[model samples]
Target: MQDKYATLAPALDSPANEGFAITPSDSSDLQQVTRALYVGEGGDLAVEMRDGASLTFKDVPQGSILPLRVRKVLQQTTAAYLVGLC
Candidate 1:
């Protein structure tokens, strides 16, 4: 049988793109999102969607990877290390 989901590798220590760092004032613009995101350990983060809606993830533990099963275009983050892949 075919796999339900594809495997994903771990997030890198450095930023993936130029706008990887999500700041307080300016929101980071993300590329085309093909798969879910894997968030690494860091402070609380806020994910902004293209439609101006937002979601906040509080106090995520270090080394934890979250599988956010959303296909919306990501606008930015508050403060968290993340990896995006399938």
Candidate 2:
């Protein structure tokens, strides 16, 4: 499963390949994500996708998708996001 989200580096490893990539779990879903907790935005996300195993966002005209089950797992444990941060 970890291999699936190759771009999602471990919290103790490297930052996400993309501006907003997954990091090792500092919260509940450690196995799914990485150091999203350390994000300058002050973490805390509400990922609703379970088996969806994929997340979506617009990189502009074209969109992108990421591993959801993994993302949700990490989001469960990350620090709560600060107000007005995202």
Candidate 3:
């Protein structure tokens, strides 16, 4: 397979080439830091940032795509069907 963008360095604004399902957990860290998060079923999305700051985005609408660098999705997250873009 030929990837036209493969030679380009990945920047924060670059398109994500990988994605994984996210399971919110307080004890476990994500296998990799996410470049963004896809909110399939949204409400309150709590997450720990790459810098280790914890935050919760309230009233996130369903099917929203959040461009965030996340380290972990906290157990307190009310959102469901989360996918991590890397």
Prediction 3 TM-score vs. true: 0.95
lDDT of 3 by residue, 1-86 (tens): 99888888999888888999999999899999999999999799999999999999998999999999999999999999999998
Candidate 1: clashing pairs of residues: none
Per-candidate TM equals 0.46, 0.18, 0.95
Candidate 2 stretches greater than 4 Å from native:
1-16, 20-38, 53-86
Best by TM-score: 3
lDDT of 1: 0.47
**What's the true lDDT of residue 35 in model 1?**
36
lDDT over C-alpha atoms for residue 25 of model 3: 96
Give the lowest summed-lDDT range of ten residues in model 2.
Answer: 58-67
Ranking by TM-score: 3, 1, 2
Please identify which of the two predictions, 1 or 3, would achieve the higher lDDT against the true structure: 3
Candidate 2 lDDT, 1-86, residue by residue in tens: 36666765455344344333344343443333322322323333444343534343222121222323333433352333211100
